[model samples]
Target: MTAIIHDAVIVTGDDEDTVHYGASIAIDGTRIAAIGPNAELQQRYPSAERIDGRGRMVMPGFANTHTHLTMTLARGVFEDLSPPHKPPFSGGLSPIPLPDMTQDERRVMAQLGALECLRSGVTFMLEDSSDIDDYAETLAGSGLRFLFGERAYDRTGTAIGDPAPFQLDRAMGEKHMATIERTFAKWNGKADGRIRIAISAWAPDMCSPELLKDLSALQSKLGTWITIHLNQIWGEVAAVQAHRNRLPTEYLADLGFLNDKVICAHCRCMDPREEKLLGDAKVIVAFNAAIAARRGLSPRIDSLERQGCTITMGSDNMAEDMVEVMRTGLFMERVRREDGRNPTPEQALRWASRNGYKAFGMADGGWLAAGNKADLIVIDTQRAHLVPMLRAVSNFVHNGQARDVQSVMVDGRWLMRDGKVLTMDEPAIVAQAQEVANKAWSRQFKKRFDKPPAGFSPAALP
Candidate 1:
């Protein structure tokens, strides 16, 4: 298959961060055949189908390094349920309980999240969750490049951020390892090599020392990447210190688990020494900016990058808008550094796209170049917010919205075109997801609380 997206603005999220005007992309099969002037590409691939890009801008799709597709069900409610940062910390992100659902309902929510990702021009994603295989079918059919970081942990009586005493269950830990292996065996190379499964340690405080060592060894044996939640909050930091007698980063480093292949999410509540060690290990930091903002926290992205760590971006749980993630990351870092122009929009675009592609081991994608993977998006440039594009990339970085993305392509295939997703039934998924969420939450919230939050509305959410 061959096609030409002719006459568009090309923002190459590459190391050079090049932006080419009035250019076209020639895609042959699953790779980009060329990138050149409109006349040149049209003359080169005469027989190819031409996609009119007259008022559109073409750029690499986003790489969401961490997210929970199934957890999308926690959207409106969980954003406000962030855990406490002060003393006497609990292990999990929030003490609030989420409604339980059947596997079918979970699948619907995952599909809805996938719909959101496609709509937002997220071509690549890394989903960190337990029993990820339950939703592997949903992801496999979504036409998105993704890494399923299957979670494994052995701690009983608590979750990640709890300061409670560690209670290790070797049998349960063994079961999780077995599940990881089974999932890998079943789905690692599926989806024409688009879907990959990676090992994940839940968090520093949740996994025992022996469990961490075993998971690390397993990762090496499988020749795959690993991800973890590290320093997500002060409570989490306290929990790790109380249990392992060391900081979170120190615990991972002491077990020889910190490496270039590891993707650490939420390094917000870190000690200076921990930051230095993470930089020394050269791990890729998954700056989950939106969730951090929701939790009133932000990572030291600039310091981590300067210290030798590769910085990338992720949407994290309860959200799927990579556009928001990228923009929020830029704003957060600027405020953290107190510099108006320190981490430029170009830098944020690099972290969100190119850096993330490399982190997921898809080095050929996430950038526009000949012979690279044909994973890109087309945005409508004629919108009111996108007018007067004197500085194309700058304007996009500062002002682009997810709704502006009208088409998405992965490996030369149209996952979405003209604002319509091709791989899934969008309307059915949306309606079914809403139905499931409403029924589930209505039942759970009623069972738990006597009344809704102060200004309760009978019609807000029945």
Candidate 2:
């Protein structure tokens, strides 16, 4: 299939921070064939299907580096609890244990999360989903790029249901390994290399050292990625410190798991040594600024960049909007630096685009250029927030939102066209998700009353 997008302002990351006006891009199958002025491309490929890009700013679609897709079912389910006031890791909301999730529930939740990603201009996602045997099957036809990391834990009573400590017995380990192998064989490199599988060990506190070591070995043997929740909260950090007498990053490093293939979701509490170790290991930090702000945690962007760690954007919670992630990242860095001009708009754009592909191991993606993957986003420049566009890129970082996303394409295929989804039926997905959520909520009516005497209303089940 050949696609030619014409008459657009192209934000091509081929050059450092450059946007070409009155340009066009030609996609031959999954790769970009040419990128130049519209007149030249039209002359070159006269018979190609023309996609008029008038009044649009075309850029690369976002790569969400880290997320828990199935957790979409828990969005509002735990917001109203008494805030974790324990010192050190003393903030952020907690999710209610949802042991009642069936395969159908898992499918619906995964679809809902994928729907949110599509709507929010997310071209790719790295998800840490639970131990649902059919997780990949549930997501098989969803038509979004994904890296499904099958969750692993060896702690007893830690997962949602068991009254005793959470532990993965040998039988459970074999089951998890077999399921992951099958998932990898089925979904890895599917949708034209848009999907893959990873080995996910929840956290140091959640997984035993032996399990962590085993996971690292399997990740290396399978030549896939490893994702872990590292230093997300202060409690996790404190627990690691007490157990290993080292920071979480240092401990992971000691285990030989903090390498380039590892995408650590949040480095909210990383110190100088840990930052250096991450950079030395070439680990990418999935900078989820919005959810971090919601939980009162922020990344050390400047320091991380200085240490040469690749930082990419992600919407950790159901806050699936990438524009909000970009805006939050820009503002949060400035506020943290206490200087208005700290993180330049150009830098913010890089984190949201090019660096995102780096985190996803898609070096040829997140850029608009010849020979790159045609994962593009077309923004409506005519919108109110985009008007008076003296500086397009700067305005994008400062004022843009997801609704400004006019179109989206992944692997040269039009997943969305002119602000409408094409791969999935939006109305139908929403309706089905709402029905499932309503039924799930009704099943446990009093599960709602466990809310704090003083706090926000509990998040209803999805």
Candidate 3:
């Protein structure tokens, strides 16, 4: 079927960063067939389905390159806690443990995350998590493009910044490797290539040297994408120094794991030397700004970009809104470099869209072009806050809310239209997620303590 979204402001996130005031995008099957002046395209595809794009801004959908979708359950619980970063390092990234959930409940939570992504105009994402097989089908059914990373780590450290002894659980490592292979075989290229698989070692401090070597070899053998948390916190940095006698980037390099196919998330604690090393390797850095700011940290994004590393944005934990991620990224970088004029909204938009797609190996996506994939979003510009849209992209970046998203199209199909998700039951998913999260947190607190954290309250289970 052919459809034409006509008569809107088109923000072509192409190499030239083109913008069209009254343009139309013609979608033929799963690819954009044409893009040009609205009247011209309307005549060109006269018989196609016409989607009135009046008072809307059509742009390539945002790509969230790094996030843990299932961690949506921890939204209110973990955001306020600050993990220790001092000499007496803690064993984990957070004090609260991950709440336990049944497989069905986990599926509901994953779908809830997908719902938020759709509502917020994210068409693509890279999700790094353990046991992705549990909700792979659920995510696929949500009609969003995904790269699922089957995470594996042998270290028994409870949290990410654990300075405990690194025990080599070879058997467990092998089992995880097998799980990765199985997950890839089962889910890679599923949903007509909308779903892909990747390799993930949870963190530098959580994986042993031998396991890293094996994972690198496996990555090369399979020729798949790899992602890992790198130098996320000061404790993690100190732990790696104590164990490997080298920085995290150097350790990954020694294991032959720092390369273009790898995406390093949360490089917030890196030094200039490590930045140079990562840049030399040409790896993509997932500059997860929202979570970084919540954790009271920010990466040297400008320096990393200057060093030839591609800067992509991710929502990380607790949230899946790429809009928030993009804006936060811009603000954080400006504050970090003390240059408000540099790293403009246009650059931040590219990082959130184009760079993210490139990191996930989608060469023709995350941009609006004739030959590019038809993964885009339409934001209603008729809202009061979005009025006087003198500068479309800049205004959208600084003032737009997720509620302004009017439609989401993926692979030439409207996954969401007129602010309604067509692929899943949104209200049902949200209600179920709330119920499941309450029970899960209640179970965790009852199993461990009588009181919840300060300023935190889990909904009482009925």
Candidate 4:
């Protein structure tokens, strides 16, 4: 089916960062067929289905390069809690513990995350999690492109950021390696190539040298992409230094894991030397700004970009809103460097879209251009806050919210239209997520403490 979206402001996130007013885009199947002035396209595709784009701004959809999809279950509980940074740092990423969930429950939770992604205009994402086989099909069915990383690690006795001795479990590493292979065999390139599989060693501190070497070899063998959490927090840096006698980036580099195809997430706590190493290796850094800011941290994004490392954005934990991620990244970097004029909105938008797509191996996506993949979003500018839209990209970047997204299209299909998701039941998913979260937290509290936690009544569970 052919569809023409006409008479809107089009932000083509191309090399020149083109902005076309009163423009139109034609989509044929899974690719963009043509783009030009509205009147010109209207006459060119006279028989195409017309989508009125009046009072709307169309642009490339956001790409989230790092996220824990099922961690949406920990939204309210973990956002406010973070690992201690001072002396006597525990080896856990968060003060609150996540509730154990069954495979079916995980699938439901992941679906909930996908619902948020579609609503928030995230067309593509790279999800870092273990045993993704459970929810791979469910996520693929959500009508969003995904790269699922089957995460593996050898340090199992303690959580990340714990100040305890490192324990390497070779058996656990082997099992995870096997799981990665199985996940690739089962889900890689599924959903008509909308779903791809990648390799993940959970974190530099949590993985042993042997496991890292094996994972690197497996990645080369499979010729797949790789992602890992590198120097995310002070505690992680300390742990890696204590165990490896080198910086986290140095350790990974020695393991032959730092390369162009590797996407290293949360490089917030790194030094100039490490940045230089990553840049020299031509790695893609997943600058997860929202979560970093929430955790009282921010990466030197400008430095990394200047050093020749590609900068991409991710929502990370607790949320999946790439709009928030993009804006937060921009603001955080500006504050970090105290340069309001540098790292403009257009650069941030490119990082959130095209850079992430390139990191995930979709060079043709994350941009609005003829012959590019039709992964784009339409935002309704007919809102109180978005009025006086003198600058389309600037206004949307600084003042826009996710609610302004009126439509989202991926692979030439309307996943969301008129502020509604087409592939998933929105209300039902929200209600189910609330129920699951409440029950799971309650059960966890009761199981661990043998009683309901303060302010949480057991009677609330049905």
Pairs in clash, predicted candidate 2: 76-459, 77-459, 155-166, 155-167, 156-165, 156-166, 156-167, 157-165, 157-166, 437-462
Local distance difference test values of all predictions, in order: 0.88, 0.76, 0.89, 0.88
TM-score quality measure for candidate 1: 0.97
Give the clashing pairs for model 4. 90-161, 90-162, 91-160, 91-161, 91-162
Name model 1 segments beyond 4 Å from true: 454-462
List candidate 2 stretches off by more than 4 Å: 77-85, 88-95, 132-135, 159-175, 445-449, 452-462
Over 1-462, each residue of candidate 2 has an lDDT whose tens digit, in order, gives: 677889888888665777888789889988899988898999999999998878888888888888767667656544343234245343233644443566787777777888778777888888887663456655555566788888777665443211233354655655666777777777778766767889887777666667788888888788998888877776676667656677888888888877888888878867888889988988888899988887777878888878878888888766577888888999999999998987988788788888888777788998888998888888888888789877878988899888888788887778888878887778877887766666665455455643333432344322
- Candidate 3 per-residue lDDT, tens place, 226-309, comes to 999999999899889888889999999888888998999999998899999999999999999999999899889988989989
Q: What local lDDT does model 3 show for residue 125? A: 92
RMSD from true fold, candidate 3: 1.3
- Clashing residue pair totals per candidate (backbone < 3 A): 4, 10, 2, 5
Tens digit of lDDT per residue, candidate 1, span 1-462?
A: 789988899998777788888889899999999999989888888999998888899999999998888788778767887888898776677666667878888889888888898899899998888788777887788899889998899999887788888898989999999999999999998999999889989998889899999999999889999999999889888998898798999989999999999999989999888889999999999999999999999988988998999999998888899999999999999999999997999888888898999888878988999999999999999999999887887798889999999999999999999988899999899889878887877777677763444443343355
Each candidate structure's TM-score, on Cα atoms with residue i matched to residue i, is: 0.97, 0.91, 0.98, 0.97
* Stretches of candidate 4 exceeding 4 Å from the true structure: 450-462
lDDT for 226 in candidate 2 is 85
Clashing pairs in 1: 90-161, 90-162, 91-161, 91-162
Question: Deviation in angstroms for 4 in model 2?
Answer: 2.4
Model 2: how far residue 174 lies from native, Å: 4.9
Winner by TM-score between candidate 2 and candidate 1? 1
